[model samples]
Target: MNGPFPAIAEASATGETADLFADIRATVGVRVVNLVWRHLATLDGALPWAWAAVKPLYLGGLPDQAAQRFRETMIVPKLASLAGDAPTSVDAVLASYDHSNTINLFALGALVAWLRDEADGGPPPPHGPRLRAPDVALPVLASEADVAPETWALVQRLNRLGDTAQPLILASMYRHLARAPAFLERVEAALAPVQADGFLDRAIAANRAAAHETAKRLAQAISAQRPPLADKIETSVSAFIDHAIAKMVTICRSIRVARGQPL
Candidate 1:
């Protein structure tokens, strides 16, 4: 279906509110649930393939029709959603494309991992793969097609969210995404803002606190040590305690955010 007029669409998408993280988290939660709603209409399941075939043409390259159905079914809906009222970075990237498009590896991976975790009764997996789309086969035409304002807006929001949530996503991926590079990029990008805000400082502080606690435990272990096993026991207990504390910090990280303090 045709969307709104260009200018109106642009205006609707271009609200430059500064605090998007809170907005996005709320939006995403709602949209994700909405995607599963039975009443919502479904897009063509095979359009993903059509986008892939047409992608190169927009870039001044030729077309390839293989894998069309998959693109139509999955990729199109995902992209269209991103272009919807509540957009994400993933949506922004897809909207940059013309008719030609393909499956998003990073997004696909994250979505899969998220779904898996949801099914398993846990939070979404954090770490995964780095997302990168090279210009490998994309041949640009002589004429420049301006990306839709809505698409660009979503891109900006995604970029913003990426900046904030990347690290947490990374940590989550390591535990969940099987160490895929695409997932890692999404995690990194999503958490980009977090990195900018020096969220790592919290992680570091948490680590240091853990280390100090470990050293104290080691001292205790040494005081209680007997003869030949004293040094070994102290070292083992110290290392074990340190590792444990570091792990504990991950749990605390989210708590700070929940409390609205700087992480």
Candidate 2:
């Protein structure tokens, strides 16, 4: 709100001509406000797509079907996506970006006002959300070598979408990866003392042993594919191996608790 809203509102208040461009921007702005409100209702840590979604709303005029598409695709996904990452302490995702609620709320309000102006035969204004920092690059999924095979695959999917903002997506990736063996290895490797002490080394070896056992059992099940699996279980064993490795990383990470914590 304070970021872009007040300036836009002041411009609207002070402009001599109620032109079409301004009006269109105003319309798009209003849609943005509604989006922010809905974002609040679906509160969690910031979404990867939040900023990207805003861009279309502010820069491109809200199409007639925009809300419907949003309801079906985005609204439903939000329920499942935030299962592990919602911020219990915070009420808004915008706060994660260091913006005060005032600025966020206001920017959206001004955009709404502009939209109303457009509905009244004001000029068709500029539309679509503007990225605050256009120079910021999207985050890439780390390679399989860097991350567990499974986490790498999921992260790759998320990175490819490019629909979400980089930081938000990365945060989610990290949050979920936090539950994977791949993340733990990265953490342990980062802390030399932890490794030198053998605390991390022992833990990693033990976890790997368990994961291998599980993968072997899972592989057997897949190969044993009974009548139901007859020609239907056409997936390659290699593919299953990769998936199993990834799942193992995720499961291990999920059950992991930090050391040096009070019991």
Candidate 3:
């Protein structure tokens, strides 16, 4: 129920850990390292070990493949769509959010798959096509201090939208979207019905199951390539992935629901 392990601030990252942060952003094709990796970096040797274990798969395109498969396999209920008369700016903001979420979910899913194998003593997955990170710009994530007062208040409100009592669980998606206050408002409005009608819960459940199956398939493919790690490290990695995956599913589904996109 509590947030996953406290993430070391990017400002404090140094040496190999800092390098890994850069590599993760580059490899994952995103501007910011998701909170999941930042939290994992807090553990002794966990970040490097886990990154190394999954790097081959990432470089080999297994993550892209898994993400594609996930997109195809998962489904969710359609809700009342955003109005056709919505402004161009609103459409642009939603498009940006959609792109960012789509890129993140699959790559994060790959990391979860590799970590699951390490935790369960499963074999490594096979390599696929060698690929490079895409050349696209992601939105700048606004720090709490930098966000406008109104936007910051809305961020707080959106963070509290879910049923959970864990006040510390901040979704980076909102922080990133804060740059567009109107967009955030649209998101809040779109998600209200899903939350009220309990579709958000159902969407989260579907995402969780999809994440699990994605990880399972990845583990089977890369089972033989998993590197050795201490039992303690493995346990910690497993726990972190479990929490991260669930939170990830929640955020991913929430965004999809907001956009009236199929989960």
TM-score of each: 0.22, 0.21, 0.72
Cα lDDT tens digits for candidate 1, 92-162 = 22222211122121121122222222212333222223222222221111111234444333333433331
Error of 2 at 28 (Å): 38
Q: Where is the poorest 10-residue window by lDDT in model 1?
A: 75-84
Q: Model 2, range 1-263, lDDT digits (tens) per residue? A: 13211112212322322232234335333212221232222222221123322333434423212222221321110011112332322112122221112122222322322222211232332333433311222222233566557666555443222122222212223323433544334433333443346543444344434333322222211111122321211121112222322222322222222221111
Ranked candidates (lDDT, high to low): 3, 2, 1
Each model's lDDT comes to: 0.25, 0.28, 0.59
lDDT of 2: 0.28
The TM-score, computed over Cα atoms with residue i paired to residue i, of candidate 2 is 0.21
- What number of clashing residue pairs does each candidate have, in the order they appear? 45, 32, 11
TM-score result, candidate 3? 0.72
Poorly placed runs, candidate 1 (over 4 Å):
1-176, 179-182, 206-227, 236-248, 251-263
Which runs in model 2 stand beyond 4 Å of their true positions? 1-172, 175-192, 223-256, 259-263
- What lDDT score is found at residue 120 in candidate 1? 28
Top candidate, metric TM-score? 3
